[model samples]
Target: MDFETEQATRYQRIIDLLSPPDGTPTSTAKLEGELEGESDDIHEAITDLIAFGELELVNSSQHGRVRLHQPTPSTKAQATLTDPTEYVWHAYITERDGLGRTRARRLFKDREVAEEHLKQIVNVETLTPVPGIKKVWCASLGSKGYTPEYAVLRREPVFQQADDPYPESR
Candidate 1:
């Protein structure tokens, strides 16, 4: 399948996994396990949905797989789309490069703070220096707005930037 088609499928898979009704089933562990087998593209999709305020991250493996919390004034909810997608992506970028793995629990810990950062950066897509990688390095703000949001993430850059411009195969 093509890129867009593949993305649609990935989104559906995650949605179906998290479709459990209110209070009846709140376990998101199984869903997480299933995606654990997915390719990197799906991983980035998950990150995108989570960042777009459509999915929630969980702590205990037995917690809600993902949630579609209703937006409310009380939930600190806001319209995420009117804002720039690139700005949100940049929230994931490090202050400085040349780093190893580091987990930031509550990855979007400061959603509003990150959104502010998003608005500041003029070109968020420029943050991604590697090829064939999802432009998820910078994206929108908010966790799709789950109460006590739990849209956690565990992403690692699979592609590294080359010092030279030519491809290794070429």
Candidate 2:
């Protein structure tokens, strides 16, 4: 990705991680650790977000803390697009039914839980094509009142072991 796109992605990730409904303040150090991003890049993103009024710097005992709250009244009109509750985690699976494939989805309040479920599905080993199992993944879904958006968080092919008992190359 180009520099601008990469920076924007990092900024979005920072916002998502910090903007829980409770309006909790997160330490800059913790955000850096979570994002596994360079200190300079993370700080730059934080600065840009602060300027945008999507985040507020907190004067906490520990240095470098920020909290996500309603932006200034001037920016309130734009809040819906950046609201904490706007995005929700969704876990989805596609499977073969009697004649065609069916898709199933589960909603999660926590991103970590959805990710764990995705991992479980992808890590399972099947000797044969498991009867209806097709594909599984987890993503974040944007709520209504605007264009629906989805961000695929995690996905991987299900692990399978070769079922051939006799070796062809032996």
Candidate 3:
């Protein structure tokens, strides 16, 4: 078989091997043994599958498992916020019914006000900090019919240290 065809076949095999019903965690060493190919090719195929979001890798020092990628609703929401430039910092108070459905959403200019309002409505534990809050680049507040739900702006760099030098600035 051609290189592309062979690679495709390998990708399918890996997907099948990692799929549910068995769902057993397969290590890289095991995959190398089972696939009967160059270790590089197998690793590349695994990377490609992960890039395509068809597979997820769970890893530790000793071994790793490849599994079918399962993304939750919250993950989907967070994905939209990956681009920091598109959003602004805003605080929101989301009131949800007993069934966990969102009943009301209110945006606040100040974080403390939003927190206080949220405290009065529901348990603090239920207050989820949404990361992305879109900015209105073009028009004033009056132009928009409804207020956007509040979410905390993720301003910290991924590589920043836990003990931020300027914590007060945040």
Candidate 4:
């Protein structure tokens, strides 16, 4: 009855407050007004946001607004490429240096782009994982330091002995 109505209102309020939830700022007062309930509803909605990992609470002096902060990979520093698929090629841009004196952003797209980028990261650098194929690094956008090492580069696909490279569609 009344409780159901209150719950529905609160739920709708949260949905409307965090629409898209892409680093958008929302205030407690706005949520409370939208819920059309007492002050406690705001707390509940905030709790929900935290549990969902969509909200980044900061002091009023810092943000001055309640907003969401999605988890993004670190692309500021350089790390070992024991794996690369764990990171996106072009998504995260990191600072690299040849002699640790120069610094620049490392943004590569595919194997070709990675080769070019690797040329810039000098001083004890090599290919992603496949040894003897130095000067190439690729990372997966899946997780941290978990690149797809299984993927072989420049390897021919195994066919059933009756396939053409570019066959016409039937």
Using lDDT as the measure, the top candidate is: 2
Q: Provide TM-scores for the models.
A: 0.34, 0.38, 0.36, 0.29
- Give Cα distance to truth, residue 26, candidate 4, Å: 2.0
Model 4, 71-145: lDDT tens digits are 332232113223434433421222111111112344433555644553444322333332222122322122455
Q: State model 3's lDDT.
A: 0.41
Candidate 4, superposed: residue stretches over 4 Å from native: 1-12, 38-40, 61-64, 72-170
In model 2, what are the clashing residue pairs, if there are any? none
Root-mean-square deviation per candidate: 17.3, 21.7, 20.0, 19.7
Q: State the lDDT of candidate 2 residue by residue for 37-127, as single tens digits.
A: 3445876666545533345677546557777644221232333244423445545432211111113345666767766665565442221
Measured on C-alpha atoms, candidate 2 has an lDDT of 0.45
Name the TM-score of candidate 2.
0.38
Give the per-residue lDDT digits (tens) of candidate 1, residues 1-170: 02365666777677666553232333455556678766556546555455534455433353434453322211122232233232222243221111111123233434455444444542232222111233333332223442221112222222222222111213
After TM-score superposition, what is the CA distance of residue 95 in candidate 3 from its true location, in Å?
39
Across 75-140, the per-residue lDDT of candidate 3 in tens digits comes to 223343445233222233321111111232455545456555545554343333211111211011
In candidate 4 the C-alpha lDDT for residue 129 amounts to 36
